[model samples]
Target: MPRLCGRRGNIRRLTRNSQLVQNRWLNRSAEDQLTDNENLRNQIAITRTNESQEQRNERHRVNTLRQRLARQRVTDTL
Candidate 1:
């Protein structure tokens, strides 16, 4: 009999990969993490500077919504 592979199998593979990546990041040295964060902030600043006003507004709106939802989740868990 042939085995059936579907969404469940794909999800398991993805979850495993995500956990591995998270573990690697968590294991990185403090200095390496600091450097990575600085580079990320610089890239974000450069991208924001190049974005149009409309794009900036949309990004800000999305970010605000994300933060609100995140806060709701934390409150719900408390």
Candidate 2:
């Protein structure tokens, strides 16, 4: 009887090689996602740090003023 042992060996080797390639791809994708998450967190922290109470109040005040002016303009147009 002819041995089919070589075919089995080739199949095992191919499976192992495919698994290794898939694992590497997944690891790289996970690493990139982690880096992106860290960057977003850092940006959020910076934005929070930059918005002090005084600046927030000023921004709110400006927005309110603009809204009032817009209403006035619409009334004038009508």
Task: Name the weakest run of 10 consecutive residues (lDDT summed) in model 2.
Answer: 3-12
Question: For model 2, how does the per-residue alpha-carbon lDDT over 1-78 read when each residue is reduced to its tens digit?
Answer: 755676574755667678898887677876787998899999988986899999889978999999999999999999
TM-score of each prediction: 0.61, 0.39
Backbone clashes in candidate 1 total 0
lDDT, candidate 1, 1-78, per-residue tens: 656578645745667678899899889999998999999999999999999999999999999999999999999999
lDDT against the true structure, each candidate: 0.90, 0.85
Q: In model 1, what are the clashing residue pairs, if there are any?
A: none
**Winning candidate number (lDDT):** 1
